[model samples]
Every structure is written in structure tokens, then in C-alpha cells.
Target: MSSNAHSFYYGGKFLSKVTDLVRSEIEPIIAARGDEFVDIEYVKEKSQNYLRIYVDKDQPGGIDIDEIAALSEEVSEKLDSLEPDPLPDPYVLELSSPGVERPIKNAKDWEKANGEYIHVGLYQKIDGKKMFEGTLKSYNDEEIELEIKIKTRRKTLTIPRKLIANARFAIEF
Candidate 1:
């Protein structure tokens, strides 16, 4: 099969085909171990292609290196046995926990993060601030409410969801 057939590209953007394949193959293995798949990325950086998979424990404490190593080995073995490889070129396979500060990519992420400290980056500045960090009070389809601190006082900021470019869990000092 042609390399193009294994890839999904349109309008000068490449979507995650190999990543999806890898995710599909490893999801069951991860779930059986009481872990959840957070995200996957297949990208070329500095002449090297990488397939990075992020996994998190379903329980509270989070996953560790040993779990990541074991999962990596299982995923590697499965990929090696595929008769027709999904990825045409060589790539490094990475598996690990999403860490303390994990990117919030979707509504599920936001929902899981309610009442947790988070940082949000906006595409356009709101109230002269492009970035905001606070406890995620609530979120909905239209907006999110964050309880921010201002000079020893607290204030709630309501930001439109459309204005946010990125969001992630945060560790406040």
C-alpha cells in the first residue's frame, strides 16, 4: 500500500492516522490495567518522527514509570507484529503519564478538571490579560468561570469558551 493510503492529510494538514491506530491497539491493554488513554501525537521534529502516547491512571495517585515502561513494551510488541505496518517510516514510540499539568483538550477534560486549579491561554486578551490562572469554578458550552486572585482578594472571571486557545491543569504555589 502507498504511504499516502496510511496517512490522512487534507488542506495542508495531517490528521492522526498512525496515532489513532496505535491508540486503538493499546487502549484495551491500557484499560485492563486500570489506566486511561489521555492523548497521542505523531509528529516529525528535527528530522525525527515520534509517536507519543500519554496515559493516566484511573485512580487518584496517577501512573508511574514502571507502568509506563510495561505499557510501552506491550504496545511495541503489538506494533511489531502487525502484518502491514500503519506507519511507513521509522518513529520513536513514547508512553508516559500526562504529568501534573496536563493539557485540557476537550469538554471531558474540562469536566474532569472542575474545582481544580487551571491555567487558560486566550486567543485574544480579556481585560488586558492573555493568560489566566485560577480554580476552575465551572464550565459549559458557552463559557467558563474561574476564581482568580487579585492583590489579596478573590474575584470570579467569566470567560467565553471561544476566546480560549489552550487550557491545562495547573499547580499553584
Candidate 2:
């Protein structure tokens, strides 16, 4: 309902500008530290405003708590020094990993997720389902082979690449 330079209120929420600015400003700082920036969320939970930063590494071990702590300190200092700060005081700045159930966001993520238990979201329903959880068998630019559970049996589904809205690593219980 309001607008400012590169910032706007959508659905009575001011998310875009703040998240965008924060993302842009901190990406270089994150990259310089050899970390991959996953996402940032600026939102209110209960009476508190939170700026939650999600970060991860492509390495086998993934990012650890010490790295998160160090990054949090550096990012806090960087935000505090910004003139005309977009973030209000009394807001919580949190930095953490996206964890094991993280989304497969790009080609690299896809490559890393091969043969792993995963979830896929589709734009349209297939077999009366828009979402599926299974082990990823294989993938190409054209499609993916997913081995899913049906009743007491396992079945492989060949889904069109274009139908995937998103994919993520999943936990099978």
C-alpha cells in the first residue's frame, strides 16, 4: 500500500525492498567469506521483527556453527554501519543453515541431489498429485526419473522437466 525507492508494500507488507537491499548488500560479504547465500526473510513473528538469513556451503561437510557465528558477527557489524538503515532497531538478526531439507535451487543443487531422497513440486497435477517425494534416480535437461512409493510397491515416474516448480532434498521416514 506504500512505495519507496526500490521498495514497495505488497499485501500491506513491506518485504521486497528490505529483503532485496539486505540480500544485495550482504551477498558480497558472504561471498568474500567463501559462503553461499541461500535466502533472507524479513518478517514479524508475534511482536518481534526478525531478519533471518539462510546460508549453506557446497562442500561435503556443509557450513558449521562456528562459521555461522563468525558470519553473524560480521553481518551485524555491516548492517549497523549502514547510513539510513532500512532495518528498525529491536529487530533480531539470525543466521543459520537451511538444513538437510533444503531446496535444490539450481543446476549445482540438482547435481548434488542425485540418487538422494528428494521432493518435487509440480505446477500441475500428475496422477492426482502436484507434489511427490521419492528417491531421485536420474535427471537430464529434458526430464527426471523418480522412484516413488505406490501402496506397497515402488514405481518410477518420468516427469517433464518443465513441470517442476521446485525440488528439494527430503527425509524419508
Candidate 3:
């Protein structure tokens, strides 16, 4: 076991800062193009480092390939031109659309996911269960209302937004 597991490492902190800078720099460009850049996540596994960008559009499912390619090229150029340079090491940069099972992270995400089947994990149990799989009826910044069909009746359950541990599109065949 590593004794440094619980400690904050400088390299990790620096990487986080770099990712933040990249996210901030790219958000405006994406927004101006009438799209949203969801998240900038750094993945370090084994001996490889990956900078993954998740983006979304108003329509459901994945975004267009041209949009992804364009954003990737633009971001690459900007990052390469940074004065002090954000990243210290070589890494693989991947820009792509968030797919069907994409996570619902914010109010806009939840709103966009409305009317779709979703699986949600709650921080606390509700009706003896901490998980729910149902159709998202509606959602705002404060709460999400899911319509769960049980028997012959449909029930709408209101869940506080912050109580959601995780949520993602539930694919049904």
C-alpha cells in the first residue's frame, strides 16, 4: 500500500490547475458556438495520461463529429500558445461528445435529460431504496421530478438536486 494515498501531491494539484485553466479557456468558445463543453477530466492510468473533454448539444445522443474535431483543433492551438504553458508533461488529448449513457451533472444536464429514462443513485434511501430507475419528468436547479410507473398508476417523486449521488441515461431495448 502507498502511504501517500491520503496526502495531496503537488503534481496532482498542478494537473488539476491545468485542467481548470483549460476548461475555463475552452468554455467561452464552446458557448459562443451555441454548444456546451460539459467537463474536462484528467485520466492517469498505468503509464499514460489522457485529457478527456466531454461536450454536449441541445439534441439528444452524441454530437456531430465535425463539431468535435473543430473544438479539438481550436483548443489544441490555444493550449499550445499559453504563455507559461499549462501542462508539464506530454498527454493524449481527446475531445468527444457525451454519449447516451452520459452522466447528468448539473441543472442544464438534468433539463436536457428530461423525458428520458434515467438511473439515479441517491445519498439517502427513499422508500427503502437508495436507487431509482424511471423517466425524468422535469428538473430545475432545485429539484428533479421523476415519473415512476408502478402497477397501473404513475407516481411523480420529487428529489432534491443535491441529494443525487449519480445519474445517467438508462438505455432500454
Return the top candidate by lDDT: 2
**Which pairs clash in model 3?**
none
Error of 3 at 104 (Å): 1.7
lDDT of 1 by residue, 9-81 (tens): 5334465566656667789988988888888877777998788888998677888889899989988998887
TM-score, predicted candidate 1 vs. hidden true structure: 0.83
Evaluated at residue 106, the lDDT of candidate 1 is: 79
- Measured by TM-score, the strongest candidate is 1
| Whole-model lDDT values for every prediction | 0.84, 0.85, 0.77
lDDT of 3 by residue, 1-173 (tens): 00111222242354325566677778888888778877677667688877888887876555799988988898888778865656667888888877778887777777778899998999999888899888999888788899987777989999998888889888854
The TM-scores of all predictions, comma-separated, are: 0.83, 0.80, 0.76
What's the lDDT for residue 155 in model 1? 98
Q: Which regions of candidate 2 fall more than 4 Å away from where they truly are? A: 1-16, 140-142
41-108, model 2: which lDDT tens digit per residue? 77777888788899988699889999999999999999997666777558899999989898787787
User: Rank order by TM-score, top first?
Assistant: 1, 2, 3
Backbone clashes under 3 angstroms, per model: 0, 0, 0
Please list the residue runs of candidate 1 whose C-alpha ends up more than 4 Å from where it truly belongs after superposition: 1-6, 9-16
